[model samples]
Target: MAEQSSPDWMALARRGRRHRMIFLGTITVFLTLVSLPVVMPYLWLLTMSVTTLGSAAVMQVFWRAAGLVAVLYLALIVLPPLMPERFRTWVPAMAAAAAVILTTLFILPLTTLNNFRFLWNPDVMAAQQGRSSTIGELPSIWSAMGNSFALAGTQTALILITATPAAYALSRLAFRGRETLSRGILLLHAFPVMALTVAIFIQSYWMGLLNSILGVVLVLTTLELPFAILILKTFFDAVPWDIEMSAVTDGASRWQAFRLVVLPQVSGGLIAVGTFTFLRGWEEYVYVTTLLIDNSHMVMSLYLFWVSQDAMGADPNLIAATGVIYLLPVVALYVFAQKYLTQISFGGIKG
Candidate 1:
């Protein structure tokens, strides 16, 4: 048999495969390295809490913590690029896994202690520390949770209803000045939220919506409108008009077509947009502070702020713990909707 040489095409194929593998390996290493610095301190926080100290001691510990973080960040930047290709991918992954373990085991619980104390009123906290036997559960936090849920839910629904149609028009319609209008919508966020609150409060006062949760809802809805429209509009633009047109040819009305065809494709986007709107309003304090005057109408954000400011029998535990609890809805919402959010963005791309 005659000796055969490698063909040009086979040689090129091998070269291409090697390039891709190397590229992937490099990317994996870089991402892993970037994540290490963030994860490492969280680990340290968790670990250090095992040994104890005073207030001043804690302050010193935090300063030392900062210095350590700076060093770790520098190490990630300088050392990762210089690492061997084989080690690059696995090193970061291993580091990240270690960081995660540290965070779960040590950091979260210690950090949580601060916020947890804030939820317990003085008598209750004193009771917890064995200073007294009498105690009470966090009634205020429970009330605020209900209030936050109601307000966030209402605002989220309105955003879906109003923002969806408006966004659809902006993305799909060819109306005059649509581009300028879209830009203008986003421009509203440029002004300080406080400035906008001032203006909205003036209107609220004149209209007798001041001191009302309804008023707070109105202000948040307006503030949220820009983001809702902008995000959904982009998603709508990604959907092909061909689907709608096909439905129209079969005698489907525009509304019917949108209901049956367009919406199915954008369900993920809808969830994402709704999640964004809910989270924004859920965490918002500015408008709630300005527009609400009635204590009865106070949502959770304002309720928490009151806890922070109230002078009578204040315990850090009461505030911090409740604040953490107050954060649960946003966390839960994120957890439930994260997959939907990704899908929606993907749908937006295809739309």
Candidate 2:
């Protein structure tokens, strides 16, 4: 019997046309949803800054940040169309990095003209003109950044060590009540993380850890455990049981098989997990706010949160500038992990 297969280009093209319309509609909706988070805050910030100075005055900090990102995006968009395909990707990334360095180290300090200073210096006015709003403090922002990096580094190391064994057990070995344990862990998210931090605060106070790094690490470790387990377990499950059996057959111990083979297979997943934990720990506000009551223990999120709010009424500009700096390690971690994000697949059938 002869079997007819597939469709001709005309018929295929008709189907493709229908799907293309649906895809375009879906993309429009998805893009709108995705853009809201970025847009709403900036809108509020724009309104706040403009209204503060009355009449019309430029906000230097926002302009500089927007300008830098805009230039990078414009370069990336235009460079590919004009340059050779071979030079497309690497050239844009290198140029963007150089731009970022220059913006931070050189251009940023020059942009800090206060709105009140308009009458003071005619040259500062001529150089910046109506385009000058005082830039935020650089020194305090740098201190916040140093604190952010330190906390992120500490949290990454702790997450890798603890999450690996816990995830391995969940992935590899079935024990009584294992399902119940996993379910409980997932259900923990039902309690608002912020509420849990409040309870942790009370506990930390009683235990005399309220203003210490240990308190911060303990809170982060607990918060990150469930997510780490889920990610690592998925990666470990993708390893074939037959491979482990064969290793056993060749006199490789289970631990040896895991160390040499299994771990290597899932290193990318581990990195992703570590990066996730580090970012959460570094940027988390509720836990740090409740647990760390002193200047010495302040991480960037708490610091920025306070600074932004006027912290019982302080400096709003300091907060805004610090918040931008606060986002760096997280951005860096994502960029690094994205390079090694490979998909592994599994099937019951094995050769």
Candidate 3:
């Protein structure tokens, strides 16, 4: 009898390839659908920023067309894993490049550039001259921005200096009431800020700290301190004591060992703490408004409020533009600190 024919390997391989492509296509379509709701509002915001009228007619025509084009382009890039073997190798790289370019385009048009243009227009500025409108009498934008930076930077520095040592002691030293102290810190952090606002104000008034940036910074630092200490203590606990002791045995003092060895080990935690403190200071509104009654001492948060309620009155576009500017720094800070943030862990927490 004739030998049985060998199995058709190429046919089986082709069948497997076809099944894989079908699975990938289904996933790609599902992801695209899931992401649309999340992405559409941002597209509308971008459309409003670039054009004077975000009318329904314009949105339906222009925005829809642009979105369809984007979807098609994304599909073309994402579906390449189903392509021939030689081309599949480049699919991931191509998809990544496309993602970066699209993200930049989406973000660039929504920045402060358009706001600056409208704010500095010759006609707009001239119209405001000697006018009694609220917008006309607003404080300088540059000044408010400067105040925010100064307050945030100073508060972050102070928190870092104070919280680091406190965290180290809590993590390394055995002292009376140490566990109670940790519990108290967590409880204090959870305490309501609004509930204590009146007491804080009265204390600030008695101490002559009201209506000053320093006063605002001090309050923000206090609110931020408990969480900072908790996070840093966890970071310190994660660091192995053996390496620190080794440095001590090499003729280094305890302080020297900590500075040279342990500190570097917790750099990620330091970054996470600094970023949290800075953002809290930067976006502070309740304490700032309640404590700083003077209009001349306005930070960006208060300035934005004034612009919305008093200055730009009914102009939603101007408000949205300002809101974009307000959000950008926070976005940038998180983007920069995300890697360090992921390094922080609560795995070492103890009862």
Candidate 4:
């Protein structure tokens, strides 16, 4: 046979790149189509919160708002890279201010904050409807928001305090039953906490934790411990022993070395664990509803429930507004912890 000519390498490379582009474009389109059903409801919820009811001009406001947002984000993506390094830092703040100003000019008049009046005016429904209602029995939105923060915050703290040390011990120490214990921890996490709701209720009642935020915090912290410990142990295992050894050689105690050197290395895991724990407590409804009998113990989840109850007239816009408010903390936490959360590592460290 004749010697094979060199393959058309450049043509093959071009074809490969073209195929990849087509595949990626197809995937992007498919995902966007799939996501629209899930995402459009939320988009409608936001628009309903801002758009005027019964107005023909509502779509006008939405398009204007969407345009402003699109431009703002486009500027964010395109302008930053073009600026000098020194001035680039200011672009985001300036862009944000521009977006706000554009919003005020284009959309503010068309929208109403009446839906959110419950934030400051507890009797907003009564005022809007000109009638007495069961809303009077419910706590103010502020009080409910405060209770949610307290419960979630306390629960997050408890998990961190307990899980961090437990994870470190399980990761670093050579002890009897360590492997079995590690597996058991994850197994416990897999078991449904909901299955024990009745037990938890009875236990809380016996312990006088029923109807108390403190009790809810403790219960939630306990439920979150297994997963938190497992996640954190992986982070601990990823840390190199040599770093701790160097610290020890420099005369640091084992505890000090672990705290200073190892802890910093696992900061990402700690943040990820804390964020999940906090969100778990924040969104917990079954336990809160089961254990917290009194309206005084209401959380954001229950508050939203009460707002949407037929007793409250189930005003769709108001309910949507409450939903938006309910989503803020979760969104804020993700925005802040996103950097570290992306650093989360699972499984054993490579040798």
lDDT of 2 at 274: 74
Scored against the true structure, residue 232 in model 4 reaches a CA lDDT of: 90
Q: What is the lDDT of residue 68 in candidate 3?
A: 51
Tell me the deviation in Å of residue 350 in model 2: 19
lDDT of 2 at 118: 22
TM-score of each: 0.66, 0.67, 0.75, 0.85
lDDT per model vs. reference: 0.69, 0.64, 0.78, 0.84
For candidate 3, lDDT tens digit of each residue in 1-351? 999999999999999988988888798789878987886666555545544554444354345546555755564657566567787777667766765676466644433344446445545423433243534345566677889999999999999999999999999889999999999999998998799899999999999999999999999999899999999999999888899999999999999998999999888899998998899998999999899877678898987786566334434555556666677789899999988877766775232
The runs of at least 3 residues in candidate 1 whose Cα sits more than 4 Å from the true structure, single-residue gaps closed, are 1-139, 174-180, 189-192, 306-319, 343-347
How far residue 154's Cα lies from its native spot in candidate 1, in Å, is: 1.1
lDDT tens per residue, model 2, 1-351: 789876698988989878876776576568657875896566335433323333232355445555665566546653455466788869777877879796787455544435223234434323432232332222233455566666667877887888788878887888998889878877874557766656788888899888887777877777777777766777777777788878888999999988987898778777777777777777777766667666665667765564444222333433333444565566677788865443322221121
lDDT of 2: 0.64
The CA-based lDDT of model 1 is what?
A: 0.69
Query: Over 4 Å off in model 3, which ranges?
Result: 1-43, 54-114, 118-136, 348-351
Candidate 4 residue pairs that clash: none
Of candidate 3, the 10-residue stretch with the lowest lDDT total is 125-134
Model 1 compared with the native: what TM-score?
A: 0.66
Q: What are the per-residue Cα lDDT tens digits for candidate 4 across 1-351?
A: 999899999999999978976776676568657865876577677877865577765687767766775577456754554456898788888889998898888878788777787787767844533433545567777889999999999999999999999999998999999999999998999998889999999999999999999999988888889989988998898888899999999999999998899998888788888998899999999999999988888999999887777766777888889999999999999999988777666784333
What's model 2's lDDT at 205?
A: 89
Model 4 global lDDT (CA atoms, 0 to 1)? 0.84
* Model 4 spans > 4 angstroms off: 1-4, 7-9, 62-109, 125-136, 348-351
Q: Candidate order by TM-score, highest to lowest?
A: 4, 3, 2, 1
